[model samples]
Every structure is written in C-alpha cells, then in structure tokens.
Target chain A: MISPIGWFIIWLGILFDILGTIGLVRFPDVYNRLQASTKCVTLGTFGIMVGIFLLKGFSPMGIKALICGAFLLLTSPVAAHALMKGSLHFGTKMWKGSVVDKYGEDKLGGEQIEKEG
Target chain B: MRYVLYFIIGFCLWLLLTLSVNLDHLIVGVVVVLLGTVLFGGYFTDKPIKFLQIHRLFWFIVYIPVFIWYMFQANIDVAYRALHPERPIKPGIVKIKTTLKTNIAKVFLANSITLTPGTMTCEIDGDYLYIHWIWVQSELVDKASEIIASRFEKWLRRIFE
Candidate 1:
C-alpha cells in the first residue's frame, strides 16, 4: 500500500498535469502553450514518477522509475526547444500581449540578408 | 583516463539495469563496457572530466536539492498561473547574456533555465540566450538574468569554473 504522503504527491502531480492541459487551451499562443506543457510534463510526470519510486523502494521497478524520471528531465526541454524553434521558424505569431520579442529582432536582420541575396 | 571513466560509467549502468550479483553478469558487463568505451569514449571531451573535480562534484551534489526545490516552486507558480481565471501571465522572449564560456556549461545553464520557474530557453547564439518567460518582469538583460538565473548561475559557476 502506498503511503499517504506518496498518494498526496501523486495527486499534486496530477493536479499540475491537469492545469497544464488547461493552459494549453487557455493560453493565447504557441509559446505560452509550450511553456505550460514543458513545465507540466517535467514536473507533473516526474513528480508522479518520484512518488512511485518512493512507494516501491529500491527494487528494479523503483530504479527503473528513477531512470525514466531522469530521462524525462533530460529530454523534455530539448523537445520543447525543438518545438519552439520550429514554431519560430514557421513564423507562428507571438501573442499580441507579449511584452518583448528579441526573436523578432534577430529574425528581422536575417530577413534583410535574405532580401539582399 | 577518459576511457577508464567511460568504462566505469558503462559498467555502473549495466549493474543498475541488470541488478545482478552473478560473476557471469560482471564478466559480461566488463566485456561490453570495454567495447563501448573503445568505440565511443572519444566523444566525451576532457572538459566534463575537468569539471568532475572533487570540489565541483560536491557543489553539483549540493545543487541537486536546491534545483529540486526550485523545480517544485516553479510547478506551483505555473500551476497557479494556469488555473487562475485571468491567467495573470505576461509572456515574452527576453535576451540574457551568460558569462559561462564552456559549451557544456552553457548547455547545462540552458537546460536549467528550461526547467526552472517561468523561463524556457528559446535559442542560444553564443553567450546570448533568448529565453521565453511566462512572466515578463523586465526587458533589461541584467535584471532578467538576476530574476531567472542568479540562484543557479552562482552554483553552476563554482561547478564549471
């Protein structure tokens, strides 16, 4: 049987995941959605995995959960970065309410080179 | 030395995966690890090994818990923003310059930023990292750096310096 603390942590993770899904629907743009999803997967899923590891102790299954958590930690951001890069490249407009856009400025210079050539 | 380090890592991974104590498993692990080290050990630069100094390793050990604490804080922060009806988020991409010189260190910083509160590294062009922040507190680079990475940058510097 899982400890109450373990169950609580798992519930928190689920709550974070559900919030992320809500952010996916509520956010104004791709970038915002990416932020929400990345954080959710990284924290929520890893939290649940850690809870499982705690519940299972040091058995092979427990160790596997730890390894999987590490893998998720390492990979999720890279995946988010790739998605963000792709979105930027495809010119998915930033939310109008965004306060700044250094990416736009950088891309403007790149565009000038494209126009000249 | 690098080859030995690779062999040790490979063997440890083998042990972890198999969770075995048999002599046969040990021998097979050694053989496979040796082959793996021979084949791919050259890919690991000396930089990582240099950062593996005892002092640096200690700081890295210390860094993990702090990182986890911040990660939890970040989750709550994001969760609050997501769940609130108003969404209370002012998103933007801000440029921040990192003094970290090594590619591996910069990569670590970028990954750390992505995992930390309210910031996701969008792109890195040299020392300048473009970060997508869920809450746009400041457009100034120094202030943004302070807000986003002051806690992590100091510790990471000690580890990677």
Candidate 2:
C-alpha cells in the first residue's frame, strides 16, 4: 500500500546514506569524515524514517520509526561535537594546504613551537 | 498565551502520533504537556510574539527535499570512505565564514554542518565557523561555509527567525 512517493523518498534516503559513506572514504581526515557522515546520515535517516512512517501509517512500527528519527537527529550532532572536541584536545593538526586556522593562534597560545624550542 | 498555544500544539502532536482517545491517556497527556509548557515558560522573556508570516513557513516544506538530496549524496560518500582499507583521510581544521546573523540561524547552520558526514562545526565566533573537515579537497573550508550559508541558512531563517 505504499505510495510511489514514499518509495522514492526511501530510495533517496538510501542514496544519501551511501554517498555519506563514500565521502567518509574519500575525505582526507577524521574531521572531514565526521562532517561527511554526521550531517548526511542524520538527515538521510530522517528521510527514510519519514518514508517508513508514511507507508506504515500510525502503527507501532511507524511510531518506533519516528522515535528513532528523532533520536538520530538529536544525538548525531552532539556526538560529532564530542569527537571534534576530543580531536582538538588531543592536538590533531590541520592539513598543510589549509589556508586559514582561525583557532591556531588562540588555541595554540600564539607561540610557535619552533621558536620556543 | 504563547505557552497555552504551545501546550495545545504539544498535546495535539501527542494525540495524533499516539492516536489514542482513551480518557486516561488524554488526561495524562494534557497534564504532562501543560506542565512542560509551564516549566518552559520560565525560560522566555516577556517579549511579544513576533509576527511570523505563514507564507515564509511554506518555504521550509519546499527546502526539505533539497536537504534530503544533499544528505543522500553525503551519506554514500561517507560510507564508501569508511569501507576503504586505505582510509584516505586528509584531516584538518578550517575557518569558515558565515552570513547568518541570528543565533538561531547560526545554531541551525552548526547543527546542519555537524549532521552532514565528514565535517564538524568545532566553534562559532561571531560570523565565523571553525569547521573541522576530514579532507581538504581544494579550498574545502571556503566551500563549506558557502554551502552552509547558501544551502541551509536562507531556509532556516524563514522557518525559525
């Protein structure tokens, strides 16, 4: 009884999920991969869950789907934030080609390690 | 009045999703939702509600599909990278400038950036977003900021601000 639109949305979600995974692989580092995975997967999952809800109507399954979607939306970004904070705390370096590091002077105390050493 | 409206909306949402009209559930839901609204009332200042245009809200619905499509593309990209044994990661932090002026829009952009795979909004100072990217694909930092402001900011401004 699922409408074509529902199926299409589900397919779109699947496609996003796949693309996010690919971005994670092709991306240069942990932070970049986190960016690729967290944003895309969260929204992608939401879309799929919405599709499921529409197809299943107001059944328990649909309710569970909605809950899952909400949980993902709420927690995924928080988790990403934690990961980034952890990486920064642990002294992860930026790529060399990176043009700007706004936090570098502030975060690293504005003292060049080479000069101090 | 706003609290009352919120309570009603919360109760209606609960009822619609739960699809239960049993007297016990209705009473409990109403009590809980009203209590939540009462608790939330303490957080807001006594400012009057800003006049929000209904037409602006409609754009959010239109933007949803675009967000979905972008998400789909990001998902596949992340999944493939994860499976790769080589783990071609270029990890780095980049400063991304944002045009969103309001706190809500900045929050939305930060959350949106975090939600997308391979990027995280590490910090937001004024109009700048300190984003950590997994890869530095060309001018990745500039691209990210532009993407956030252009793709999501306008819609979020419409919906919440």
Candidate 3:
C-alpha cells in the first residue's frame, strides 16, 4: 500500500505541475514563462517520480522510475540552457524591467545581430 | 582505470537499489555494464584523466544528497507561491556575483541554480550570474547571490577546485 507521504507527494507534484502551467500562461514574456515552466515542471516531475518509487517499492518498475528521474534531472536544465542561449543568440529582447544586459558588451565581439542560421 | 570506475559505479548503484546478491544476476549485470563501459570509453578517450579527477568525483557523491535536500526545500517554496491565490510573484531579474573561477565550477553553479525551483540562470558572465527569480524573496540582490554561492558554490568548489 502506498504510504500517506507518497500520496501527499503525488498530490504536491500534480499541484506544482498545474501551477507551472498557469505561470506559463500568465507570465508576460518568453524568459519569464520559460523560468516558470522549466523550474516548476522539473520539480513536479521529480516529485511524481519519487512518489512512484515509494509506492512501487524496490521493484524493477521502481528502478525504471529512478532511471527516468535521473535522466530528467540531467536533461531538463541543459535543455533550458540551450533554449536560453538560442533565444539570446537570436536577439530576443528581454522584458523592459530587466535590470541588466551582461551580454551587451560581450567579449566575443560578434555582430549586434546574430547571423541568421 | 576509467572503465574500472564506470564499472564499479554501475555495479554498486545496481546492487544498492536492487539489493540483490544472486550470482547469476551479478554476473549478467557486471558483464553487461562492463561492455557498456568499454563502448563508452571511446567517447572520452581523448579527455585527460586529470580533467575527471577521481577525488572530485568522491566529493560530488557526498554533496548530491545535500543538494537534493535544498532542491526539495526550493520545490516546496515554489509550489506554495504557485498555488497561492495572490501569486505573490515579483517576476524580476537579478544579477548575482559568483566566486567560482573555473569554468567547470561556474557551469555547475549555473546548472544547479537553474535546476532549483523558482530561479533560472539567465546568463553566466564570467563570475556573475544573471538569474531570473519568480519571487523576490530578498530585497537585496546580494542576499540571493550569497545564498547560492554559500550553499552550492562551496560544495561545487570542493568537487571541482
């Protein structure tokens, strides 16, 4: 039987996933929405994986869950990084309130506009 | 030596999670894992051994559980903000200065910050990290910088410095 904690985690995961979707919809810009989606969804997925592991015990299915969790953890951030880098490279403008543009005087000395791929 | 490390990590992880001691399963696992490691070794043969320091790997293992705890804590905070009716999100970007000098440590810190809920690493400029935080918990941007540097950077330095 799944423990109370496992059920709680599952519910929390669902709650967080829904919240992330809401943030994605409500956020004003691409960067903000990306932040909401990537961070919340990753944690939500992780919580669900942990709950599944607890419910399934140490069976092969649990092992598979762990593997999936690890993969998700490793790839999600990398994918987000790639997306951000690509956006920046493509000259996507930040929200007006953005405080800093550290890349404005980039050392690479590339052109103001990224070369079209 | 690299293959040996890979084999041991794979075997131990398998054993610990499976908690199995059957000789047949052990043999099969070892053979399959070892073969995989051999095939994988080709991908890293050009990289120097010093780059993947064994002692650093040990520290990384020691730090993972602590990192997970921090992640869980961040997850709860994000979930709370997300579920609250007020939505209480400031939705701003903050520049946090980092002390990690090496590229590896900087990459680790950037990835770690991005992985944690509610914060995203927007840009890594030398020792500065431009982060987009969903909720501005601290008024002082330095406070967030200190929090990340002290919590994850120290451990990452131990692993990679």
Clash count, candidate 3: 0
lDDT digits (tens) for residues A2-113 of candidate 3: 7888889888888778878887886656776787788778878988998888888888777778778887988898789889777767777666544444444343243232
Q: What order do candidates take by DockQ, descending?
A: 1, 2, 3
Q: Could you report the Cα RMSD, in angstroms, for every candidate shown? A: 4.1, 4.8, 5.7
Ranking by TM-score: 1, 2, 3
Candidate topping lDDT: 1
- Say which candidate scores most in TM-score: 1
Tell me candidate 2's fraction of native contacts, as a decimal between 0 and 1: 0.52
Candidate 2's TM-score reads 0.73
The DockQ of predicted model 2 stands at 0.39
Model number with the top DockQ: 1
RMSD of 2: 4.8
**Clashes per candidate (backbone, < 3 Å):** 0, 61, 0
DockQ for each model: 0.68, 0.39, 0.28
Better of 1 and 3 by lDDT: 1
Which ranges of candidate 1 are over 4 A from the true structure? A110-117, B22-40
